[model samples]
Target chain A: MAMSSALQNGLIQLQLFEEYSWVFNLLFYVIFVVFIFYGQRIQMYVMLREVEGSLFKLKYIKDEGRKIAIETIKEIGKPQTDPAVRVDRFLEYFTIGPQSLDPAGVVWKLEHILDIRDVRFKDEVKLMAPATDDTQAHNLENTLEAAMALNFIYKIIRHFYLLGKKTLSLYIIMQIQMILPLIMREAEAYASALKAFAYGQPIGDGAGALVAAKLMRGHEIRKVPKDCVVATVPIEGRTTFVMKAEGPGGNVGKIGDAIKTVIDENEGKIATIIMIDAAMKLEGEEVGEVAEGVGAAIGGPGVDQFKIEESILKHHIPINAVIVREDIGDAVSPMRKEIFESADKAIERIKQLMLERTKEGDKVIIAGVGNSIGIGQ
Target chain B: MSKTQSNATTRISSFVLLIIFLTLALSLTALILATTFFGQGNEIIAGYLLLIGFIGVALSTYVLFQTRRRMLRLRIEIPPIVTTIECRKCGFKSVREFQRGDYIFKEGEPCQKCNEKMLITAIYREVKDKEKTA
Candidate 1:
């Protein structure tokens, strides 16, 4: 009976950890870390699968906004694009609106493409609130991205710390350790940006778009693209077409195509093309600071810039620009009070500049060139 | 920017969490009473009771931290200021907190740098932690 009891005691005692001397523990940790990396990759892959999953739960946009969001997410999830391209595509969608099938910010196109009924689309848009603004709209998207990235990185770290018994192979651990600081910095940036988004403040970059939306005052406006709209107003007797991305939806509709369509309909009679957008300021420049300049003063992949420039050149028209200065962070998050307030100032500036440059009866094109995500025309 | 509204799951879990906390507290108390038998010759039972108490402490601590963190996150406030004043002729501007009377196109002070008219052209707030915005 005593021998049997001793045998049971031996069975209960776990010496395997000490016997293997932690090598096995280290291997397990490495494997866990590797598993975490793969898990993140797999999760990301599954999120884009017809976009019917938990990732949608993380999305903050809903209803009509969801309509735009689903299209944007699907585009970003295109498996064929490279990682860099995917990021670029995401930025483009958030800032510029959907491309390819619908280059112009046309409402009917979205309705047809998404197979959304016209009456249903209208009702969904009616549910949109102007207060949602461009910065606030994109901030939600950034928050989701930051959260996903942070969770992935955190899981890797936790797996290693837990499974590896807090120690591992020197070389690989050293490599991970070295890269961790840099990764940490990137993570820090994401964290701050997420906080900025949470508060619904405008990033420094979104000032131009906000000002453009201010120019629209946009009740009863017409749709041009995803989250983009346009309105025609006669300024000083000149037929002016004001275009901007639809507000409260984080859509930067295709401003270039919108301009092209107006120019074509006007039969190249656009005398002066005035573009207003937010510009990144040099150090010492103030946020919400407005400036007037020559040329387009529009920033993007040059697709829209080229289209606007070509159309202007074809019409032999003079192009003027007004720019709002802001930092990169403020450009894409929520619309700040200053940026929102700057809209009034930007509107006044645009009016003065257009009056100064164009004669009465001139067909002038005033385009608010920026991501119109939260900024409605 | 958009408002961050809490999901339904968070609200439901909050009630569930309170129940869990109370139950765990009672369980830890019972475990401690069992541990008093350590000197009564039931040492193995006392040891197991002590282990359960330790686990309860760890779980309770985690739950407490999680609750506090989530509560703090929900108390997001609105940012005080949103506009920036800038110069049209030259690069001069100032940022200030929002006032009730503030609106677009309202003229403010003259430019500090070039003496041009400094108009309130852009309204935006610099985002920082604890600074809420609309």
Candidate 2:
């Protein structure tokens, strides 16, 4: 009997121990989940604060015109079905209309879109008084407050989700270390090409082709003169800048316009109008690689690539383009090695083309199409 | 350039770190439970740990495999287009065509009349033309 009792006790002890372990595990998992949630919440809060600060700083800048632009953009904001579509619509509105603001205008517009006005206590009280009784009014107010709170929570959660996604995307980008050297090399080549053109050194098939096309199209050309006025326009994109120069001589609107005017004034001397712009590459494209092609011109806001293209076509000029395809990031940033190498190759091509088209004395025009930000144009 | 690549590298490393963390957490919990329940000869508990480890490794391996496969499939679907030019100096014309980088021209060079130095200018689709012809 004693033996059987002891056996029962042993079995009960084992069962209790097993149950205890299970409970402990459950508690551990719960704690772990709580830790992760809290950590993420804190991270989200920090990001929100940073974004809010940037927005506030933008608002404080003394620009009434920008403020008005912002207000207008905010009023026009509607829920978009697709993110890309929304961005495109925003860009259209931001760029096309007479109301279109520059980058400063864009900053103000974003600010007004995100602005939140505080609810007045007196107004709330007045609204509550419309209720049948004090109790009812109080209840209505409470409900409204609850709804507002819920809405606020929803917005916060949405923002947190966006932040998390951005963070994850950045993390993924961090892992691909193999592509950087190529981007740098390309950026440098691009910068050097611009510099060379700015100094009036005849380089590349693109330069020559541009000259030939310009001359063919009836743009006036000049042989390398002792002192020629050269204008540089840098075409900027989402990533990189393509700097090109117009053949020397002629003062017009901006550098781009100056080049166009020069071509117009010296008609019949220019052979071709080659517009060098940054091109996006397919996946697995080598960094800083040059892809020569005849394609549509691409540029940023305020730099009218299309206008240039139209002008060229209007004059019946045969247009050729020498595009250096760099990864998106390298295109925007300036002075990498690849940009220099590509520029060198492009210049070499232009030189070869020039030798083929005209004698040593023939003048050519090359326009660097991009934003003149880092390299002082 | 360094900064951009570093960002990508850090992201991949973080993923690996996350997997390691989850595995460690799982193993630690199992160990704690095993110590509590299987007091003396815990060989069976050790076996459970081994099983969990195997499962974790398998899951991670599967994730890596899926990611690599997706990348490869994307590459095959959108291979880079290389431009080829048949410069017929005799004809005084250059015939430009889009070709795959691996494709070989009929004349073993880019010239139209006789084999001569040819430059690849642009790449576009030949498949659409072929489809139309068919």
Best by TM-score: 1
Q: What are the runs in model 1 whose C-alpha is more than 4 Å off?
A: A1-204, A218-220, B1-134
Q: Docking quality tier of candidate 1?
A: incorrect
User: What's the distance in Å from true for residue A129, model 1?
Assistant: 19
lDDT of 2: 0.39
Candidate 2: list runs displaced more than 4 Å: A1-256, A295-298, A301-303, A357-363, B1-134
lDDT of 1: 0.56
Q: TM-score of the B chain in model 2?
A: 0.35
Q: Cα deviation of B84 in candidate 1 (Å)?
A: 15
> True-contact fraction for model 1?
0.19
TM-score for each predicted model, relative to the true structure? 0.44, 0.36
Q: What is the DockQ of candidate 1?
A: 0.14
